[model samples]
Target: NEVFDNLAMFAGYGFNKSHSAAYGMVTYQTAYLKAHHPVHMMAALMTNDADRTERVVRLINETKGMGIEVRPPDVNASSLDFTVAEGAIRFGLGAVKGVGHSAIEGILQARKDGPFLNLYDFCERVDLQKVNKRVVETLVKCGAFDSLADGPLPAGDLEALGHWRGRVDAAVATAFSLGQKKQADRDAGQGSLFDVADGLEAGPVSYPEASPWSDQVLLDAEKQCLGFYVSGHPLDRYEEELGVYATHTTETLERAAEREAVKIGGVVAELKERRSKRNDSRNAFLTFEDRAGQCEVLVFGARYAEFEDLLKKGEPLLVQGSVRIEGDEEPRERKIICDKVQLLLDAREELVNKVTVQLEADSLDEATVCELRDIFKKHQGDCATYLRLRVTLAGQAHFKLPVEYSVRPTDDLLQAVERLFGRGSVSLG
Candidate 1:
């Protein structure tokens, strides 16, 4: 009798009347808000995920899919939390890695006075002890200091701004030092007593000249600061080159059929390694990305062994894989089961048709011709080489001259050509 009563009790069960009604109302309200106020809902969602970086990246991508732009962290406009500005989402400074809560509070407190005029103003105003040089450097690298120098800089303040010739690092360092010295003087009660001119301002500080950082270096620094790419992807410049070798981009995986073979090209963004449970064979799962989006690639067994040497972070690669689907649903996910991989440098030789160097007739001389020949000889391969000359006469005349020898379309050769004739003068078709 007791066993029968226990089975009957399990057979009929229901929630409390009040609890069921409350849950149903809450569910309906949530659904209504998500359906009606998607932007506000996403803003709340992102704000709730402030402490989680990977979640932020995923949400940023989701925001992009919804046609909303997420601007980089800016000192002039950002707040303690993510805020909507000018029809875009502004990244919160608090989300920046290596930036402590104290530093963020200090920045916000300082900005309450007014917008920072320049790098000097920023350094002078903020509590450098909490927001020190390292934190400032990270902010600058992630483009938080960009708005300060956007407009025309004041006269005699170029060195203070450090924006002259892209010497931001040197500029920021000098500004911080000046601010530190000023603070020390104030603390020590060492105000200038001998000054005949009490209100005269100091002259322009001198800053060293430095070339701008290359795109790759800048992007790497951004990734370190923000935990993902914001301004641009590393593979952005190679989009044209990849079109010839890649059958699909990471963004196109949605329409791809499961088990269909496809070729993709991207820079390796992340990699994870594990040992199999059965035989302890090495395997890995990698995340690679192009300008379009990022996708995951699984490398196991012989494939892992074959490409282990090339599977490095930030390396450009072309991968052959089969599409995989998780479920038959409206928002189905697609991943790649990597079968083969090749370095982009190697793919260039097989994909390029010819290297064309465009030059003006006035610039063409015996030395120039000999130098071009030397460059071609250094990278000898099967890709044909050509010279396009623009001659100025009664009317503009163009001449297409073929080189006697073919050369490998290597990156070094392309860079050399660009250096000789300036950028956009070299092309590979």
Candidate 2:
């Protein structure tokens, strides 16, 4: 009777030899292709599931792991499907949230005629009905129009990019109006009756220079549109502070032995609230992402309540936890059971002892000195501030001078000092 029961169970679960062989062969082929032709394979994978934002984000991380870059969507270069370009995968326009198939077709058709010279040219050519203001905003946020910009942007200048983007966006309506008027005049084969003998030149449309958005603002915009940071992780700004506190990065956490105690810092990328099965108390799961990658953190019961306010999306967090590796998984295979949580800014404040600024002796004018004093006055705090004045003459050494009053060593204060003196001029000890 026991043998009969075992036979029935095997019959219910087993597959034929031919079927097993077919499945194995297909898996082998896929693994072989992925190993040898990662770019092509990833492009196909991305193209196939372009509509699923979460899946696209995961695949994008996978592509990065394979050392393949995923370029932002380009109005001039992108297609309906993800395409291999310059050894990288360019994001498909169809995948962009507000962009639709009609817009993709129109953009492709317009590009076929000639590459768009600028935002004005794009507005003139593409079908506005399909590609509206909302679509343009989304494209700008995701860097689709980057190639069409006036020149190459400085790396690590997302704020500058944001400022420039705001100006360009503010000018879009006027540019579109001018472009449309020109097209209308051409179609009618008649210049405006008041037009000058020399074909009317719409003098270059100019935009008022605007202040740059903060780094967090830029990253938030990226998060809104692309479901992840494409240019750089938000935690990148706090790398130095994180290095001081974190024992392991997300990548290192994965390679660590299970149950190893670790401290990690990252911006909260995702959060889900749940009720515990046993006690019905509120618990939370968070996806924390640093420059290296992301890891999952579990906050249960009392711990969840303690850190609930700090669990905001886009906020940076420092977590003390232990590694929790489950049965093998392909993507995002590591987890953390958080023991303690603190805001990353709070951690920085506790770790940093002093702030230092560097200046050239010759450049320290009376006006500059007043501005420096005002900056210090603006941020009165407990952390001591020091200045290093560089003397250019040979045999004259730089000297350090400590200010009598200490100032608060907040991120805002650091940013303000950096902005006035330029980055790399300010340091925290």
Q: Which of the numbered candidates is closest to the native, going by highest lDDT?
A: 2
Compared with the true structure, model 1 gives a TM-score of 0.75
Q: Candidate 2 overall Cα lDDT vs. reference?
A: 0.78
Candidate 1 residue-wise lDDT at 92: 85
Badly placed stretches (over 4 Å) of model 2 are 1-37, 65-67, 172-203, 208-211, 256-260, 277-280, 323-325, 328-334, 358-373, 387-400, 403-405
Clashing pairs in 1: none
My TM-score estimates for the predictions, one after another, are: 0.75, 0.80
Backbone clashes in model 2: 2
For all candidates in order, the CA lDDT equals 0.77, 0.78
RMSD after Cα superposition, model 2: 5.3
Candidate 1 lDDT by residue in tens digits, 1-429: 999998777656534656779999999987888688766667677888988987888888888888888888888898878888777889888788889899999899989987776677778778898989999888888878766654554432322333432666768888899778866876788757543243244334444677766556667777888878876676654567887778899888778998999999988878899999999999998888776778889999889998998987465788998999887777788889998999877787778887778888898899988888788888887887777777775444544445556888766787677768876788777
Model 2: which residue pairs collide? Answer: 381-407, 381-408
When summed lDDT is taken over every stretch of 10 residues in candidate 1, the lowest stretch is: 156-165
